[model samples]
Target chain A: MTKYSPPLAERIARGIGHLMFLLGGTWGVFIALPVSVAIAADPIQLAIWGVFMGSGVVAAFAAWRGLYLIEYATIPAMAAGTLIYVAAITNVVATGENPGSGLALFLMIALFSYLTARWFSLNQLLDGPLKLLFKRRQGLDE
Target chain B: MSIGTVITLIAAVLGSSTLAAIITAFVNSKRNKSQSETEARAQYTVEFNAIVAQQNIQIERLEKRVNQLEKAEDYIDVLIAGITNGTIPPIPPRI
Candidate 1:
């Protein structure tokens, strides 16, 4: 009989990655607002903040989906989402709303999402148990 | 908070978030490098196993061919020995 092995590193990496994404979302919503409010942007700027915050929510959802599905989906989705976000922020900047704030928020979200996604993907790739799971799923001998 | 206060607050928030993100990216990248190395090692082990299996098959096939050739040589030697000893000479009158 063949022995079975598990991918421990990969699993731990994925769990940590998802947890980061979840926390990133939490920071965007609750922490960001109060921080922005304390500094005092105009109504239009506040609206921009809301938009940035909305994008963060979308990113978090996509990352969560990756965690459950492909283990690598988070990276691509987050990257694409960040590109879209940068574009959105660029438009807002052109409109003469406190562009710096929007750009800063965009950068932060992009960095967080990218890091989280990468962590998960790499973790899964290195996991011994995960490899066995994949082989088993394909009906190959372990 | 006054409008100016709010604007300042937003700036501060954005700045802090950016700092946090940069720090996170740095940490994550470090971890990612190690993970990628591990994955490569695992992949290499599988490939090594496959190569070994193929080599085993080839060796087995070559050994079989050698065995067959040895048997043919033995038979030829026996025929030659019989002929030299005159025990199995070429007979012309039997026909």
Candidate 2:
């Protein structure tokens, strides 16, 4: 039999990560679809929702992996999301139609999410620092 | 006395005892503080001596370097004198 050896804390973190992944997946599907459908008349609005939902999935995956590995993982997905939203905005601007406020909000959210990920990475709060704090003493190791 | 009165009296006694204990502890600590300070002073002296020794080593090293530089300066002065007297070829300082 394979040895099942993970610290209690790590096991808990992974469990929580899986739970968050499931919840975020469900939430993303439910929340994005109806709203995008409602905004389907406007191609720009639809594009914004599509990008938001796609990046939302990536962000959710990043969060899950961050917890699973107990490290701040790469969050370039949000940056890509910003780029896509900006492209959508550019399209609207090129067409001389106002892209409206919704796309702007999604763009802001993408930037904010990237900043949040960066803050987490810099602080290393959840795992790196806390793990160091509670590490078992080397002297006591068998 | 009622149970409430008795409890109140007990609490008051316990509080006063605790306060007295704290005061006694503080007084004892104050008395022994000189001894603690003396130990600390001894530790400080040891550390100060170590730092002074390291400083002395550094001073000796710097003094040796200064002595070497002085010797070099003297040699250069003699060389300049020899050049002035045509005993040695003049070397340009620019190079």
- Tens digit per residue, CA lDDT, model 1, A32-129: 64443424445555444444444434334433333222333234333432333344454445556656767566675767566556645444444343
lDDT of 2: 0.43
lDDT of each: 0.49, 0.43
**Candidate 1: misplaced stretches above 4 Å?**
A1-17, A26-70, A102-142, B1-41, B44-95
Q: Cα deviation in Å at residue B66, candidate 2?
A: 12
Per-residue lDDT for B73 in model 1?
Answer: 78
lDDT of 2 by residue, B1-95 (tens): 43223323433443343344334334334442222322434545676899999999999999999998997787788788987898885543631
Candidate 2 lDDT for residue B16: 47
lDDT of 2 by residue, A101-141 (tens): 45665655665475456534423322233233355454356
Across B4-90, the per-residue lDDT of candidate 1 in tens digits comes to 443445445554544444444444444433333334447657778999999999999999999989977777777788799989745
Label model 2 with its docking quality class: incorrect
Per-residue lDDT for A126 in model 1?
43
